[model samples]
Target: MTVVTPVAARVTEGRSLTWRVSLSEAADADMSTMFVVVPATAPGLSTKDVPARWPRDTAGAKPDPERPLSKVDGLYLFVDVPAGRTSADVTLPTLGDRVAEPAEPVRFRQTDMDTGEPLPDGLVLSGSVLDAS
Candidate 1:
């Protein structure tokens, strides 16, 4: 199973939010991609904005540059996970000056990089809420 949690309970304006992605076990060859979906109505949030930092490997060697997070369709962020890794940290940029406090929680999904098919038991709901000040 895959789980995502916010690194901080509250964030400030113009600052990025960090999320920790944890897998119950190491990823297999088929499970290579993970997607984090945020609400589209989030204030001051845009998919075009680049993440403040690169994803950091938490349970292995340095993060794979080829596996950096990329925004998709202006709604979700996806990253390629190295096989045998259990956890990683991803930082997303929050632009503009307006406060962003979405009512809905963030969601997570894992899929095969090549086939683009979701893995069994890959969809997780309500991972965390983004609370920006």
Candidate 2:
């Protein structure tokens, strides 16, 4: 099972969602794995943005220029976490600010990198748009 938690309410704001993520266990399924999913209905968020520094290795290796995070199911952003890594500070790209509306919370799910399995209930990360600009 995987666990996802928001470090703070303000996880930085830009063209996408940038925040730190901690994994109870490393996800070592394959070269390409699905670590998280941000739904389109996640309240004012878009998954069309290009992912930044994706396909990264937690050991400080350069990001894989070939592999990148992309939209799936038309609206969900499937984030890829490196295999064999337990934690990372991740920055996922988005077309618009995740917090398009004030005070509303943006939500995301932690999933098995390879199987696309969501974590158990009550393990999602959520926060408001502290800095939409």
Candidate 3:
């Protein structure tokens, strides 16, 4: 899994901001699941943390993105689904629903749903506005 990018900013003032974050397979083929993580080489990698579940609707926001951890907005990790495959499934390794923004570097990893093999390239760590509530 990849971290995409570490967010650096103070918590929003006044009202809280809602952030809709997504971490999915960025490859052309369908991936069973994706991971958001700080690379082992990254300074503050936490093996106990779990990535946030990505929303399926890639075109628009279905559920509002705002949440308590919305401060770490603009960071996304993704992969594309392969042909003949149209579904994504992932097993969360920890209890945390969303990973906290790391104080150091990180990356997202796409893996097979069954085999757990790393998906081919096309992964990225980008700072793009996803959607907001």
The candidate that achieves the highest lDDT relative to the unseen native structure: 1
1 or 2: which has the higher TM-score? 1
| Clash totals for all candidate models | 0, 1, 25
Off by over 4 Å in 3: 1-32, 36-41, 47-102, 125-133
Write candidate 2's Cα lDDT for 5-50 as tens digits: 5555454444445555556678775233233444424343322233
lDDT values for all models: 0.45, 0.44, 0.31
RMSD of 1: 8.9
Using TM-score as the measure, the top candidate is 1
lDDT by residue for model 3 (24-115), tens: 43545444344433243434322222233432222222223442222232222334345454433322221222433433223444445454
lDDT of 3 at 79: 43
Per-prediction TM-score to the true structure, in the order listed: 0.46, 0.42, 0.28
